[model samples]
Target: MQFDRKGLSDEDLLRFYLAILKPRMIEEKMLVLLRQGRISKWFSGIGQEAISVGAALALQPDEWVMPLHRNLGIFTTRGMPLHKLFQQWQGQKEGYSKGRERSFHFGSGEHHICGMISHLGPQLSIADGVALAHKLRREDKVSLSFTGDGGTSEGDFHEALNVSAVWDLPVIFIIENNGYGLSTPVSEQYRCESLVQRAKGYGMEGVCIDGNNLLTVYDTIKGVREYCIREQKPYLIECMTFRMRGHEEASGTKYVPPELFVQWAEKDPVKKFEEWLLLEGVLTYSHMEQVKASMKAEIESELVRAELGGPIVPVTTEELEDVYAPVPEVGTDKDIETVRQFSTSRPIRFIDAIKEGLKSGMEEHSNLVLMGQDIADYGGAFKITEGFVELFGKERVRNTPLCESAILGAALGLSLEGFKSMVEMQFADFVSVGLNQIVNNLAKIHYRWGQHADVVVRLPTGAGVGAGPFHSQSNEAWFVHTPGLKIVYPSTPEDAKGLLLASLADPNPVLFFEHKALYRSISGEVPEAYYTIPIGKARIVQEGSDLSIITYGAAVHWAKEYADQHPELSIDIVDLRSLLPLDYDAIRASVTRTGKVIVLHEDTLTGGIGGEISAWIGEHCFELLDAPVLRCASLDTPVPFNLELEKNFLAKSRLATTVDRLLRY
Candidate 1:
């Protein structure tokens, strides 16, 4: 009940009261609608409206916000149309996400609101990227994000805090430390006494506030916002309160102790604020009721409009249309246009090709940034970015903490600000720790909300080195199954450079798989000028009529070596540079030329990308076959460490035998 006005005028205080009351009223009505089978579900913020309303009011108009499901006040206060929000809740196409996602799970760029995903942690890291963009642009804007007590347990939470602290990003991480995460209590969430106290571990300042007090909440957040912009420092604010309702409408409050509810009931935020306003003579009881009635009437009007709005129109073609932004230019021969006469080209290493492409992108696009562990001064595990730190400076060539999810989220955040970012995973296997961000957030974001994650993830993949299973993994299959992600794997240096440049140009997320074994082992004729090989296109590495070998990455070398060993047996080698939108024309053309095909890859056979390619070929080119498609891939077991065992496990051991058998058949 005790608070400071913090120089806020009486008008501002009255505005905060209305802002807080509006969401509370909406939530109350939503519960009624949910029971009537109107909307799918609603996460009610009945008691926690103060934090959202206060934060929205305190932050600058240009600053961005990432809020959770329960914080509807943030959206309502930020000028999101109540009709659109209600329509969104009703699963309408006119809503923000076009009925793809419901229940406050979609972001609105117009309102500077990035809605929280179910995962709850990527948003924090993404906000870091947004702040990074502002800092780089010298816009002096900050990014704000919200999470519940349960979210602090996620690795992304720790990673986000550490990365933001290390970078000194202007981000405010607010934790609505409601007593429980779902049914679990804060007692079981973390051993720390207070969540705000943990901020010291990350080397940042933090403040805990009475979340139920509207004046205190707004004053505290306003101070933090000013501090962050003035000092360009990350800060943490723990808003201590209770979730009066269950996690959702369906989830009851049986687990909550009766005495705890009784204790919190005395501190009902809205009632207490109303009492204060009356005691301070800000308004009469009649005026307060009139104000509340007007707001209620507005909500009812919007709700009726929302109900009248039609549901998502089920158009089969429209469903497939907007999955990717600026949908990739597939199958065009972009390579031949710029670089002709390969005989006069210069030989460049595969690693150098990536470096060259990155250099070119940086020169062309001032917004492009590079981030990864040990990539700045150490030049990465493969030394692909050697001397980049001095050339590009530390800001552009950033050495991030070992946080894959955080950096990927940051890359997506950068894209929101018209900046392109390339994130490097020291090894392909490490991406497993952050696959959720890639598959869920980055992949579905464009489809869900028309936000392009213009990010190119450099995954150093494939086996054949002495690295154990953790370091060497051909996990492209995981992302191949995931839609909205562009997968590019190049064999030769020229393709690596061109494909990388093209991937950079893409608006969607691109997984640039750089074969570890081929980085230094192979060299190819690459042009110096900037050019791009069209994504989703295949190249004929060696043309012949006897049999066809379709492969990519290091396996391309293995197939060629075997072909050179046999002079009598003519072979056609097709290197599929892009895997997502498989070059069906090129795949069928090579298969038709020989009527025999051998699919070769270094990835394990089971659930490999080869299965998809072979299945497509069987479905499309079944009549063109002289023999059953032979897939020469590594065994299903873990990649071995021994050189001889690795050779036996790799496709090289099976390529010769499979090719001869197909040729003889």
Candidate 2:
């Protein structure tokens, strides 16, 4: 095939060849290290270097790149130091992820590149978010994201494409169609004639190109990037490339047909590019050989330095650190205590208090953004965000499609780009659709990379009158099991506003559960001014000595009402606002004084958070317990649709009976 420079200068063409050579040499060295037992594993993109190098050369320095695991060419092209890459592979503390991540799992914030995660397609939405933020700020930058042909089967891929197309985000979604996803071939993965064809359905332009040709790959990517940035819209490119090696060094080509391996090996991108450069007289054969020799020497020197750096020292005491971002100072001039003096004299509904807090948060932080289904013009399902569109404008108070996983994934990307996002799930039960991204990506980001996602997912949770299982669910127990997540369940308007404001200021990912049942039923004096209730602290709603009822969310209100009716019991109510970071100090003090305890929650009995609280109290306050710790939770059955059955299931009468039995025992 004839070489097509496409108006590129000789220097640019030479740089592309160098870009391909650097990663090729580095990856080859990594494989040697793997065999030497110096590195744990290596996932080489041996014949696919042109795709990453082409795309990296096309992107502007300020534009962001979200490369997949095999895109080592991106790291070298983006100016990542050879020593840092070797240190990461050697598990040294000088690595980008502080030795917590391996291989290409660590990203460089300084280079505008996000590290790769094993779960393939979620990063598309994250890239979309980065592009969206740039557009909102009227910046001219774009984002380039990569995925494999196998990743197109993931639901996140579809969601990301649809949303990016609808929003006209400036992003280029590149699919490196390397013929296999691990061991499964493209035929088994999907029925489409070509993955690029799916882009047409998303209302975006699509193209298929010869990924083996360095000049063609570079020209195609540069043109697509320019078009995306100029039109402020997304584009899809399917690079038909092949990986000459297996998925990883440990995985051999036994599953792949020998004929297919031979076919792809003959078209190695590095060899093809070098031959093209030689034919075009862009460089002499000796000059090309010199470049290869220099790259090999550099890789070897870095490997030596990495080996001498020693393994990272594990600090057991520091294991629990950096789980959450430190809470920012409450407000411009007012702290929590000072703001408390200015509390609103009149009572307001719980929903209004949340809205007020959001308004205050947005006004305080210019980077704060709100995105959810029907949250813009429709004001959301319960009208909690009513009039937000006009107040904040569509750019800040954006409405999103019903793709929960992509919505949260985008929010995570926005958070990484210095935006604090408040993402509302229309119904907390619907969070199941996006649970994979939340559990695997958002929750583990901090622990894995020392990065904090300043994002709040507002979950309208719990059961009340008629809403059945899907609409009403107390899912806090599910999140309490997850580390690196802060969970807040407020029972009153005052606490609701305070806690919501606090969550916004927190640097970690927070699950803010606003009980759907208490939106209107609960009313209290919520401060008009911004104030924060410290996380991990419990409030003593009512102080007493005889018995203690420990609860949170809507159950706190039920417990308070039960205590009010029976004055003889003299029960103390401990409202736990935070679930993950349990208020053990307050619980210890309350249990020590009362000598009897009852744990209450609206979730089912078997795996409810009540059991965790009960077990902790049993182990820590065993001697202080006047009787065995008692639990009052709904029966372990799906919430029924019939109002009568629902009432019977979570009846206050049942809770009263349980409390009465505990006191008598």
Candidate 3:
């Protein structure tokens, strides 16, 4: 496809030039603020405003866009207030993203702009997912993501592009080739002549545009966007712009050669567009001055408004604010209605239930996709998704390489593209490898910018059957401490199926814990249709007034077994499917009913769920408890390969043992 520059009118060029003046001024004023100690740093877009503004104008309003730190021009051109932009640069609470993000981080949920991450090209994967979502919803919305020329070196960029190319996703990846990365020149960054040419490696289209020419850049992006929507293909657009300023305020331009600086400064995009507008008679010199004056006055007003609000006071609670939309209404009595009776079906085994849940959910929602290592034809390591490829086809159920970090990093891009993805870590123990991508990048995106990322991560956790420490382990505690994530560990197949479905539907990132021990250990009947068990709710498995035992995952089954054996002792069992949002209400109710409580988990004693649960119970339900709230967990040691040693470290919570312990207490 080619840009029809002749079709463009003077009016289009005039408006485009006017849109860039504000962002350009914002960049200049921010640099001055940095020097005046009003801001800490600034990444100027003096010579590159045209490319940023032009690309943003080419996309539809609801289409997704992920911008790099230097692309503030794009957001400003798309209606981001400069005062809000200044507030972000000054680290104020009234900043563009409500103090959640730093300078260069701005997004609008209403416009469908995904959040930004500092990591190079990581948002590229998110853009892919966002586009995938649009495709699933049968919407024409596309996703556009930007990165610096240096970002192409990151694995995330390549991974996202490869996946998008293979899937024919509606995405456009833009590389703002601004001559240098910090002090490092482009020649040192890559061997390629232009960044766009790298798209050939992923079997995608590529184009280069004169970044200084606003009309040329805008027309090229418009053509490429049309191709993306109509052909459903990803494209790499390389805009050859120049960085007239240093990488940041702290860095002087001393490293750059004087000759190159003068050359780019002479071709300044803002100036070129302004002069072109005057020559075309679309705008007068006085009209240009009026626009600038209006922008300055508006920016000054926003600055005053931003100063009215200061830095945010952190949330006191460990858990984030609740985000539960579309709560399921209580079903009418099954006996009274035939439809209600049909909906309330019998429970199924955790393993079978999970498979059926995924199948049903995938069929019901086209935007829902399953991806991870060995998930497609290999059916996942534990066969939890044994026949997913056959059911959803290769497009939806995909297998990936063994790199856990890449799997997660790529999923971030796909989520940004608008696809809700369920990514498996193969084994819960291996999730540590991708912890940076999950905790640092994905989990923090929403907190960084009030943006939503709907992605589900499934990890097979718990120890038993001699998988050894490397494979057999529950790592929920590691993530529980991390904010901006929801954790769910379900014991039964029914709860597993329900929780997995619910997690998929959640608007933010969810970590779904599946126990390897329960994969095929038990069997039960389940409904053939779709259903969801809420993320933060708890289920009372067995009720008693004597004592309360709180547990989740394999420990829940063990707790149940112990309760069954000790018929003489009265005990209450509560399975906490959601970990981040501990069903404290149910726990408190159980604690109030029985004045004694024991929290248990398969993980080590230190920093485990038991410790947190025990502490919470002590703080909130302390007066109601007759006995001290206690916790039982495995000994603090690596999970040994020997069966006897492993069993010795396991919490002794069998029915008889638990009953005897409570009686002694």
Q: Which candidate is the best by TM-score?
A: 2
**lDDT (Cα, tens digit) per residue for candidate 3, span 543-583:** 89888888888888788877787787788999988998788
lDDT of each: 0.88, 0.86, 0.77
**lDDT digits (tens) for residues 303-348 of candidate 2:** 7776677666888666577555556665544455676676544699
Query: Number of the top candidate by lDDT?
Result: 1
Sort by lDDT, best first: 1, 2, 3
Error of 3 at 599 (Å): 2.8
Candidate 3 — number of clashing residue pairs? 24
Better of 2 and 3 by lDDT: 2
lDDT of 1 by residue, 14-67 (tens): 888898899989988898899899887888888888899999999876688989
Q: Estimate the TM-score for candidate 2.
A: 0.98
Output the better candidate (1/2) by TM-score: 2
Error of 3 at 64 (Å): 1.7
What ordering of candidates by TM-score runs from best to worst?
2, 1, 3
* Candidate 2, poorest ten consecutive residues by summed lDDT: 325-334
Query: Stretches of candidate 2 above 4 Å error?
Result: 331-333, 651-653
